[model samples]
Target chain A: MQQMNQILRRIPVWAVYLIGALPAPWLFYQGLTGGLGVNPIEALEHRYGELALQLLIGVLALSPLRRFLGLNLLKFRRALGVLTFTYVTLHLLVWLVLDVQVPSQIWADIVKRPYITVGMAAFALMLPLAVTSNNLSVRKLGPRWRSLQRLVFPAAILGGLHYVILAKGFQVEPLVYLSAIVVLLMLRMPISGVLTRTRQADST
Target chain B: GVGLAGMAQGAAAQETLEPNTWEEITSYNNFYEFGTGKDDPAKYAGALTTEPWSVKIDGLVDNPGDYDFKDIMSEMTVEERIYRFRCVEAWSMVIPWNGFELADLLNMAGVQEGAKFVAFETALIPDEMPGVRYPILEWPYREGLRLDEAMHPLTIMATGIYDRPIPNQNGAPLRLVVPWKYGFKSIKSIVRITVTDVEPPTSWNMSNPREYGFYSNVNPNVNHPRWSQASEREIGGGLFAKRIPTLMFNGYEKEVAGLYEGMDLSQYY
Candidate 1:
C-alpha cells in the first residue's frame, strides 16, 4: 500500500490534466473528420457532456477512496475538477455556437427547457468550485474552501438528473450511472456518526 | 399527374432527388422498436424476422383478410419516387423509395364507404426487440392518416431503396412512406392496416399528446414544445455545419397543402 502511494505520488498532476484533456482534441478531430457519424453536432455534445459527468464523478469518489480504501488520489483531485469544468464549458459552447446558433432561441432554451435549466444550474454550481480549485485560494480560504467544495455533491446530483431527464425514455445506461453516483454519495455520508454523536450530546 | 405517369416507366426512369447516400440510409435510422440510438436498430435488428411477413387488412374494409406478403408484392404495380423525409426531431433525409401508392392497396382492400381514416400498426415482438422491454411507447406502435391523405399519390408503401431490399434497420419488408409528413407518421415494419370511420389512437400522440399531435404534418411555424421546427440539419453533415431553413410541408406544399385547405394548420399541428 505504501509502495502504491509512492507510485501514485510519482504521477504528476500535469500528466493527469494532459491525459484528461486528450478526449477534447480527439473528439474535435472526430467531429471535423466525420468520424462522429451522422449528426456530428449531437454526438460531440453528448460525448463532452458524458466526459464532464464522468470526471466529476471521479473527483467526488477521491475523498471516500482515500478515507476507506487507502488510495489517496487527493493530489489529482483539483486537476480532475478543472478538467471536468473544461469539458462542460466545451459542451455548452458547441451547443450554443454550432447547434443552436440563434442567440434569442438559445436564451429561450436555457430558460424554458427543464433539462437545460437543471444543467445550467449544475454548471453554475461548478463555476465556484472550479474557480477555487487552486493552491492560492485553498491556502487563503483554509477550512472555508472545504465547505465551498462540498457544492460538488449537489452539482454531481444535478448532472446525473440532467442526463436522466434528457433521455427520451427509460435508458439503462444513464440510470446505471446515476445509481452509481448515489451509492458513492451514500458511502461518503457520515450519517451513522452524526446520529450517534447527537444522541451522546443529548445524554450529556 | 405527369409524375405518376413517369413512374409507370419503372426503375430506369426513377426520379432521384437530393438523395442521401446508401451508407447513410443503412447506417443511420430511428426505429425505436428495435432501439433508440441511430445505430442500435442496425446492430440489434438482425434478430427481427422480416421475411414471410403478412399484413392483416380489416375494419370497415370490404375484403378484410390476411394478405400474404409475396402476393401483395406480385399484385401491386411498383414505382420509384425520390422523396424528402423529415423527422419531428428536426433532422431530415432524402430517399428514393420503390413501392406502389397506398391508395392502390386500399383499393385492393375495397374500402367501405364509411371509412374515413387509415390506421397502421408495426410489429411488436418483445422477445426479439430489446427496446420493447421498456414502454418507450405503448407497444405495437400505431399511426394513422385521414382517408384523403392515405389516398394521396405521395403516400406509398415502400419495400425497397436504391433498387435493393431495404436493410432491416430501415424498416425492411414493408413500411409506409408519407413524404410530406414527419417520418414517424410513416410507420415501419407494418403488420396491420385498418380502415376506420373514427380516428385511431396513434402511439406518439398517446405517449405525449401535447408534443406530438395526430396530424404531425411537417410545419416550420409550429414548434414541438421542446425544440424549434424552423430549421433542420441534414444528416451526414459534419459538426459545425450550417443548418438550412425548414420548408413548410418539407417542400411538398405545392402538392399537399390543398389537403388541409379550410383548416388551421397551427391548431391542427
Candidate 2:
C-alpha cells in the first residue's frame, strides 16, 4: 500500500488533466471520420454525456475510497472535477449546436421536458462548483468551501436521474449508474460511530 | 380531376426529394427485434434467413393461408415511391421504396365484410434476433392501422429500396411503409398480417400508451414526452447540419388528415 501511494505521488496532477481531455478530441475526430456509426451527432452527444457521468461517479468515489480503504486520491480530485464539467459542457454543446439547432426549441425543451429540466438543473448546480474549484476560493471561503462543495452530492443524484428519465423504456444501464452514485453517497455517511456502538452493544 | 391533381403533386414532390444512399438507409435502422441501437440491426441481422419467406394472412380474410413471397410478387405490380420517413425519435430520412400498394395485397386475400382494422406482425426468431431474448419490447413486433388507412393508396408493402432487394437490416423481403405515420408504425420483416374488426395491440403503444398512441402519426405540434417532435435532424446530414421543422403527418397531411378529421391529434398522440 505504501509503495502504491509513493507511485501515485510521483504522478503529477497535470497528467491527469491531460489524459482526461484526450477523449474529447479523439471522439470528435471519430465523429468527423464516420467512426461513430451513421448517426454521428447523436452518438457523439451520448458518448460525451456518458463520459461526464462516469467522471462524476469517479469524483463522488474519491472520499469513499479514502474513508473505507485509505487510498488517497485527493490530488487528482480537482482535475477529475474539472474534467467532469468539461465533458458535461461538451455534451450540452453537442445537443445545442449539433443535435438541436433551434434556439426556441432548446429553451422549450429545457423548460418543458422533465429529463432535460433535471439535466439542466444538474449542470446549473455544477457551474458554481467549477467556478470555485481553484485554491484562491478555497482560501477565501475557509470551511464554507467544504459546505458549498457538498452541492455535488445532489448534483450527482440529479445527473443520474436525468439519464434514467431520458432513457427509452426500462434500461438497466442508466439504473446501474444511478445505483452506483447512490451507493457512493451512502458510503460517505459518517457511520463509524454507529458501527462502534453496535459493536459495544454486542460485546455487552 | 382530384386524383390527377394528387398525382401531379406527388410527381413534384418526387422531383424535389433526394433519397438517402442505400448504405445509409440499410446501415441506420430501428428494427428493435434485432437490437435497440441504430447499428445493431446492421451488425447482427445478417444471421437472419430470408429465403423462402411466407406471410400468413388470417383473421377476417376469406383466403387465410401462408402466401409465398414469390407468388405475392408475381401477382402484384411493383413501383417506386419517394417518401419522407420520419422516426418518433426525431430523425428524418428520404427513401425511394419499391413495392405494391398494400390495398392490392389485402384485396387478393379478400377482406371480410366486418373487418375494421389490419394488424401486421414481424418474424420472431430468438436465435437470429438476440434482442428478442430480452423484453426490450413485446416480441413479434406488432403494428396496426384502421381499415381505410390500410387501403390508402400511399400505404405500401415495400420489398426493396433503391432498385435492390432490401437487406435484412432494413427489413428483408417485405415490410410496411406507411409514409404518414412515424417510422415504427411501418413494421419491418413482416411474417403475418391479420384483418380484424377490433383495434389490435401495437408493440410500442402496448409498452407505453402515453408516449406511443395507436395512430402514431407524425405531428410536429405533439411533442414526445422525452423530446420535442417540433423539428427533426435529417439522418446522413453530417455533424453540423441544422435540424429542419417537422411537417404535419410528415408532409402527407393532404392525403391522410381526412382519416382523423373529427379526432383530436394531441389526445390521440
Candidate 3:
C-alpha cells in the first residue's frame, strides 16, 4: 500500500487532468465522423453524462479507498472533481446546443423536467466547490473549506438521481450508478465514528 | 379526372418527402423486443427468423386464422408510402415504407359488429430476442388503435423499406406504421392482430400510465413527462443540425385531425 501511494504521488495531477479531458474531444470527433452511430447528438450527450457519473463515482471512491485500504489518492481528488465538472458541462452543452437546440425549450426543460431540475441543481451545487478548489481558497477558508467541499455528497446523490429519473422505463444501469454512490457515502460513516472513539480512548 | 388529380397531388407531395437512407432506417430503431438501445436491434435482431412467418388474426372477426406471410402479400395491393416518423423520445425521421393499408387486411378478415378497436402484438422469441429475456417491457410488445384509426388510409402494415424487404432490426416480415401517432404505436415484427371492443393494453402505457398514453398521437402542445415534445431532432441530421418544430399529428393534421375532432389531444396524449 505504501509503495502504491509513493507511485501515485509521482504521477503529476496535471497528467490526471489531461488524461481525463482527452475523451471529450475524442468523443466530439467521433460524433463528427459518424462513428457514434445514427443519432450522434444523443449518443454524445449520453456518453458525456455517463463519463461524468463515472468520474463522480471515482471521486466518491477516493475517501473510502484511503479510509479502509489506506490507498491515498487525495492528491488527485481535485483533478478528478474538476474533470467530473468538465464532463458535466460538456453533457449540458451537448444537450443545449446539439440535442435540444431551442432557446425557450432549454429553459423550459431545466424548469419543468424533474430529471433536468435535479441535474441542474447538482451542477449548481458543484459551482462553489469548483471555484474554491485552489490553494489560496484552501488557505483562506481553512476548516470551512472542508465543510463546503462536503457539498459533493449531496451533489453526487443528485447526479445519480438525475440519471435514474431520466432513463426511459425501469433501466438497471441508472439504478446501479445511484446504488454505487449511496454505498460509497455509507462506507464513509462507520469508520469515522470508530476513529473518533479510538482517539477519545487514547486521550483518557 | 378526380383520381388523376389526386395522383398528381400525391406525386407532388412525394417530391417533398425526403426519405432517410436505407442504412439510417434499418440501423436506428426502437424495437424493445430486440433491445432498448437504438442500435441494440441492429446488433442482435439478425438472429430472428422472419421467413415463413404467420400472423394470427383473431377476436371479433368473421374469419380468424393464422395467415401466412406469403398469402397476405399476394392478396394485398402493395404500394409505396412516404411518412414522417416521430418517436416519443422527440426524434423524427422521414421513411419510405412499402406495404398495404391495414384497413385492407382488417377488411379481408371481415370486421364484426362488435369490433371497436384493433390490437396488435409483436413476435416474442426469447431465444432469438435477447431483450425479451429481461423484463425491460412486458414481452410480445402490444399496441392498439380505435377502429376508425385502424381503418384510416395512412395506417399500413409495412413489409419493406427502400423497395427492399425490411431487415430484421427494422421489423422484418411485417410491421405496423401509423404515421400520425408516435412510433411505438407502430409496433414492429407483428405476430398477432386482434379486433375487439375493449381498448387493448399497450406495452408502454402498461409500463408507465403517467408517461405513455394509449392514444399517443403526435401533438406539439402536449409535452412528454420527461421532455418537451414541441420540437424534435431530425435523426439523419448531423451533430450541428438544428432542431425542427414538431407538427400537430406529425403534419398529418389534414388527414387525421377529423378522427379526434371533439377529443382533447393533451388528455389523450
Pick by DockQ: which candidate is best? 3
Per residue, candidate 1 scores C-alpha lDDT tens digits across A4-103 of 9999999988999999999999999998987888888988999999999899889878876875566888999889999999999999999899898888
Question: lDDT of each prediction vs. the true structure?
Answer: 0.87, 0.91, 0.90
**Each model's DockQ?**
0.56, 0.62, 0.72
Q: Any runs in candidate 3 off by more than 4 Å, and if so which?
A: A191-204, B1-11
Looking at candidate 3, what is the lDDT of residue A203?
71
The digit string of per-residue lDDT tens for model 3 on A39-157 reads 99999999999999999999999988887677999999999999999999999988888887778778888998999999999999999999998999999999999999999999999
The digit string of per-residue lDDT tens for model 1 on B136-249 reads 778889999999999988889999998998778888789999987999999998999999999999998998888888999999999887788999988877786788899888
CAPRI accuracy category, model 1: medium
Candidate 1: clashing pairs of residues? none
* TM-score value, chain A, candidate 2: 0.94
Model 3: number of backbone collisions:
0
Listed for each candidate, the true contacts retained, as a fraction, are 0.53, 0.61, 0.71
User: Residue A64 CA error for candidate 1 (Å)?
Assistant: 3.0
Model 2: per-residue Cα lDDT over B1-269, one tens digit each: 12666767767877888988887898899887777788989999999999989999999999999999999999999999999999999999999999999999999999999999999999999989988877778788999999999998889999999889988998988999999899999999999999999999999899999899999899999989888898898888787767899999899877778789899989987
Clashing pairs in 3: none
Residue pairs of candidate 2 with colliding backbone atoms: none
Q: By DockQ thresholds, what CAPRI class is model 3?
A: medium
DockQ of 2: 0.62
lDDT of 3 by residue, B152-242 (tens): 8778999999899988888888999998899989988899999999999999999999999989999989888888888888888888878
Q: Candidate 2 vs candidate 3: which has greater lDDT?
A: 2
